[model samples]
Target: MTTTKFLTDEHLSGRVFDGGWTTVASVSDVTEPATGKAIGKVGMTDAAGIAGAAAAARKAQKGWAAAKPDDRAAVFPKAVAAGYEYWDEIVEWIMRESGSVRAKAEFELTLSLKAIQIAGAMPYEAQGLVLPSETGRTSLAKRRPLGVVGVIAPFNFPLYLAMRAVAPALAVGNAVVLKPDPRTTICGGFVIARLFELAGLPAGVLHVLAGRGDAGEALCSDDNIAMIQFTGSTNAGRMVGQNASKHLKKVSLELGGKNSLIILDDADMELALKNAAWGVYLHQGQICMSAGRVLVHKSIIEEFSARLAEKAKALPVGDPMSGTVALGPLINQQQLDHAKSVIEQSVAQGATLLAGGTTDGLFLAPTVLRDVTPAMSAYNEEVFGPVAVLVPFETDDEAVQLANDTEYGLSAAVVSKDVARAIALGERLNCGLLHINDQTVNDDVVNPFGGVGASGNGTSIGGPANWDLFTEWQWMTIKGTPPAYPF
Candidate 1:
C-alpha cells in the first residue's frame, strides 16, 4: 500500500496551543514505526509553553465551570461527529504512528467515540446531595471541578486514553492541559485538539502540548494544575505521582501490568486457546491488560502449550499498512530491544522456547515459552510485546498464587467449564479487572477502568468513578436566620 498525505499542515501546524495553535522553534519529526519514515513534524513545547498552557487553562476554567450542565454536555456529541467525519485519516495516523493494525485502530476509534458519548451525560448526573440539617438550616454536599487537570497519555491507544480523561474532565467543568506521548503527537494530541475545536469548545478549555518528560514535569509541578491523570508505564507513573505529590496535587496513575490468564483442567480447550491467543497477541500485546502469563493446570499444560505454540507460529506478522496481518511492528527500536531482551533472559532462566524468539526488524514473531517459572523475566515483568509465557500449576491454589505473585494488578482472567469455579478463582487474583471465560484485554466505556498496586494508584476512570476522579466534594449550609452564638 502506498502512503499518501493523510496528515497535512493543518494537523501539524503546532504542538502547544490553548485556544489557537502556535508553532514552536524546536520541532521533532514524527516517524512511522513500521517504515521508519518521517511522516510529519510536531512543535516541541518547553517549560515556558507548559506554564503558558497551565495559566490559560486556569483562566478559562471559571467560565467553563459556570456554563450550564446541558451546555457542557452538548460539545461531546459534536466532537464525536467530527471524529467520525475524519475517521479514516485518524485511523491511518494511529496505524502509521503507533504501529497498530487496522482492527486495533478501529477498535480504538470505536472506544474513543463511546467515551465521548458517555462523558456527555456526566454533567447531568447528580452532582450533590441534600442532607438533613440541624437548627432548621439546610445542609448540602456538592461536587466541584478541580480547576485545571493535567492529562499525560501514552503512545499505545493514545486516542482512547486521552479522550477518556479529557472528555470527562471537560464535561465535569474542569479545564485540561493534555501532554500526549511525543511518539504519537499527531493521533493523540493533534486529533483531540481538532475535534474539540470543531465542536466549538470554549477557548483555553483544552490545551495540547506535545513534548517530552520536561514538558510533563512542568505540567505536574505547575501550581495552577490541581490534578494529574497519567496513563503510562509504572516507572513513569511513579515519577509523575511523586512530582504531583510535591506540589500537593491529586494524581491518578494507570500504570503497567503483568496480567495472567488461568486455565483449569476442566476448561474447554477451544475456548481457552482462543482467549489465550487473543489476550497475548492482540495489538502485539502492547496493552496494559495484555496477558503476560498463561497459567495452566498440570493435567492440561502439555496439550495447551503445544496448541498455543502452533497458534503463535501461524500468526502473520508484518507492516499493518502493507497487508492484512495478525500482528504489526513494535512502536520503535527501544520496544523491540526490550522485548528481545525479555525473551532471551527468560530462556536463559530455564524456560523452554516452544515457538518464535525471532524478530524481523521491528516486527517480532508471536512467541511462546513453556515451563516458565516465577523467577523468569517473562513471568515477572511486562514484555509489552506478542510473547506468551506458559506456567503449570497443580491446583487452583497454586494458580491463584502464581497470578497474584506480580506487583501489577491491572487485569486477569480465568477459564473453566464450571462457571462457579472460574468466578471463584478470578476473585482471588489481585487485579482490578477480572474476566471469567474471556480474555484479559476487554473494556467498555461504562466500566470503572483502573487497577491496583503497581498497576494504578487505586483510582478508577469511567462511569461514576469519573465523578470522583475529576471532582472534589464541598459541604454547604443555608439558613434563613442567623443562629444565636456567643463570640
Candidate 2:
C-alpha cells in the first residue's frame, strides 16, 4: 500500500474551508475507535466562522444559479471523479474515524460516488412544469434555487450522508455551508472541499465547517442560510427543526430510528437468517436503519433465535484495518458506553442476553437478546451498536403492532414465503422505506429517502426529492393577448 499524508500527519489535521483551505486555533483530536489513539486532529470553527460561511454561500449562490444548468451539473461529475481518485484515503479515514470494516467502508465510498453521480444527472432530469390556466396566458411554474443551504451531517456514514445533501444542493444550483461531525472532519468535510475544489467548483460555492454541536446550532440559526438539511439523532433533529422554524428557513431532517424486522413463520429460513444478521450487525449496527427490533412469529422464534445467536457469535471483531474483520468498534467511547448501558438495562428488565454482551475497548461484541418485551429499553430505544433484540409475536397483527410501537418510523423489513402477505404487513408498518425479504439497511439514490413522525420533517433527500427541498417554486404567466377589463 502506498503512503498518504492525509491521516498520518498531525499538522495536516482539522483543515477548514470557508473560501479556501486553512486551519483555526481551536482544535480537537480525531481518535481511532478501536484504540483511543489520536490519529488526527481538526480545527474547530466558531459561530462567527459559520456565519461567514453562510454569507459566503449566499454570495456564491446567485452567480451559480444564474449559470446554465448544464454548467452547474458539470461540476458534480468532476467531483465524483476526484472522490474515486482518493478512494483509498477516504476509505482509510472512514475506517479509522467511524470504525467501519473494510466492506462497510467500501459501501460508504460507493454511496458517495452514486450520490455525486445522481446529483450530476439532476440538472437535465429535474425542471419546471407547464400548467393549463385561464384564457390568453401561458402559465408555468419554475424552480429557483434557495440561495445558501446549511447541511449538518452525522458521524456515522459521514462522507456518504453528507454528500447525499451537499451534492444535491450544489447540483440544483444552491451554494452550501456544510458542518460535518467533528469526529469525522478529515474525510467528511476537509476531503469533500478538496474534491470540489479539484473539480473546479468556484470559490465559496461549498464551504466546509468542522465543529461540535455549538457550530451546528449556529448554522441552523444563521440568517444568511436559506435552508437547513440535517441528519442526526431524533433529539438533535428536533432542535435543528425548531431553530430553523424560528428563522422561517426551510429544514430537512433525516433522524434516528428503532427500525424493526419481522420474520413470518413461513419465511425461508436461510433468507431470514441472512437478513437478520445483516439488518442488525452491518457496520457494527451503527446506522439509522439498523434493525434494533426483530419480531418473529412464535412458532419459529426459538429456532430462529438460535441461528441468529450463532451468526452474532461468529462475527469477527477487531481493527477495521484488518481485511478479515467483519465487525469494528463503535464510533467512540460514548457510543460504546451507551450501547453497553442499554444492553445491561434491558437485561435488568428481563430481556435475556442470549449471546455476546461484553466489550473490548470500543469494540462491543455482536450481541443478541431474546424475550425482549416492548417495554424493554433496548426494544424501544435506538441502540446504535451491534445489538439485536428478538421479540416474539403470536400473530401477524401482533407483529405489525410491535413494529409500529416505536416513536421512530424510519425503515422496516418483512420476510415471508407469502409475498402478498408480506406486502400487506409492510404496508401497515410506519416507515419511509420498506423491504420485503430483505434487511432494513437498504437505500437507492433514486428513491425518496426520509422517515415519518420523529424520523424527519419537511422533505426527502435523494434524486428528484432533493430538488423540492433546495428550490422554491414560483409561478409565471406570459400574456399572449390583452387582458379583459372587469367593467
Candidate 3:
C-alpha cells in the first residue's frame, strides 16, 4: 500500500482548494452511520457559493482544454499514485460515512484509481476521421471537449461514483464542479479535492461542494456549466433531467435499479447460492445494481430458498471496521426505517419473511424473503437494503417476462450451466448489463454501464463510451481551390 505524509483529523474538513486548503464556508458535522458518532465535518456552501465555484471552474476549463493532450495525460500518474498513498485514509472515511465494509471500501478505492488512469489515456485514444468529399475538397471530423461539467453523486459508492464522472471530465480537458451527497461529504467531497491537489492539479480545475438539493439545483442551473452527469435515485434523476432541460445542457444519468437474478434449472447450485449472497448483501445492498429480486426455477425454489436463507444467516453483520463483518449498517436511520417498512408491507401483501427481517438501530440483518408476488411492494420497489426477495418462475419465458415487467432496466443476471441457453435468455432480459452464470452486482472500468426506461435515458459510461458522452463531434470541409459556379 502506498502512504501519504501523516494527516491530522483537522485536515480532512471540507476545505476549498481554490489555491490552498482554506475554510471558505460554514461546515456540517458528519456522523458515522453505524455508531451515530460525530466522525467529522464537511464544508457546506449555499447556492450562490456553489455558483462561485462553477464560475471558477468555467474559467480554468479554457486553458486546460487548450493545453497539449500529453500535458493533460501527465496529471494522472501523480493522481493515481496519490490515490494509492491515501488509500487507507479514504477507506476509513468511506466505511464510516457510507457504511461500507472494508472489502467494499477497498474495491471503491481501487476502481477510483483505475478510473483516473483510464480517463487520462483517453485524450490520446480519441481519433479524428477523414471523410470522402467532392473533387478538390477534403472533409474531416474531430471530437472536442465539452465545457465545464457539473457532477452530482450519490451517497452509496460515493468515491467511485463521483470519480466515475469527475476523472473522465477532467481527462477530456473539461473542468468539473462536483456536488456530493451531504451525508458522505468527507469521503465523497473533501477527500476528492485533496486527492487532485496531491496530484498537483492546478487551481480551479476541479471544485468540490457539499450541500442538499438546493445546492445541486444551483449547479445544474448554472448557465456556465455545459453539461451535468448524475448518479442517484430515479426520482432525483428526473429532477436533474428537467433542470438541465431548462438550459438544454448535455446530461448523462445512472439512476436506480430493481435488478433480477434468475437461476435456471441447470445452474450450479453451490455457485448460484454463493453469488446470490455476494450480489445482494455486499455493501448492505445499497448498490444500484444489487439484486433486488431473485427468480428461481420453480422446481428448485424450495431448495434454493432454504440454502440462501442459511447463507444469509451465516454472514456476519456488525461494525464495518471489524474486517470480518460481511454486512454493514444502512447509510442512516431513514434508510433503516424505510427498509423495515418495505418488508412489513411486503409481508402484508403475502410475501413470506424467510430468514431475516429484523433491524438493530441502523444495521439490518441480511434478509431473504420467499413467496413474493408481482404485486408486492418489495417486488416492485427498490428496498436499498440487504433484502432479497425470491419469486418462483416455471419457464424461461416467464422469468424474462417477470424481469422486464418493472420500469427499471438497469441490470439483470442469469445463472445456468448451459452457455447457449443462458446467452439466449440473457438476450431477452431488458437491462443495460447482464451477468451470465453470475449475479447482478458487477462493474468494471471497461464496459458500457447505463440503463433504459425509468432507470435512465440510456446514456452510457465507461471505456470509449465515456469519450463519446463527454465530447462533441465537429465536421470541417475545405476546398482545395476556388470552386466553379454551381450547376
Winner by lDDT: 1
RMSD of each: 2.1, 1.8, 1.6
Cα lDDT over the full model 1: 0.91
lDDT of 2 by residue, 123-237 (tens): 8874799899887788999998888989998888898899889988888889999998988887777777877887889898999888787888899888899899999999999
The whole-model lDDT of each prediction reads: 0.91, 0.87, 0.87
Which candidate ranks first by TM-score, i.e. highest?
1
- How many residue pairs clash in each candidate at the backbone level? 0, 2, 0
**What lDDT does candidate 3 reach at residue 243?**
95
* Of candidates 2 and 1, the better by TM-score: 1
Residue 154 accuracy (lDDT) in model 2: 89
Off by over 4 Å in 1: 1-7
lDDT of 1 by residue, 366-409 (tens): 99999899888998989999999999999999999999998899
Query: lDDT (0-100) at residue 68 of candidate 2?
Result: 85
Candidate 3 residue runs with Cα over 4 Å from true position = 1-10, 482-487
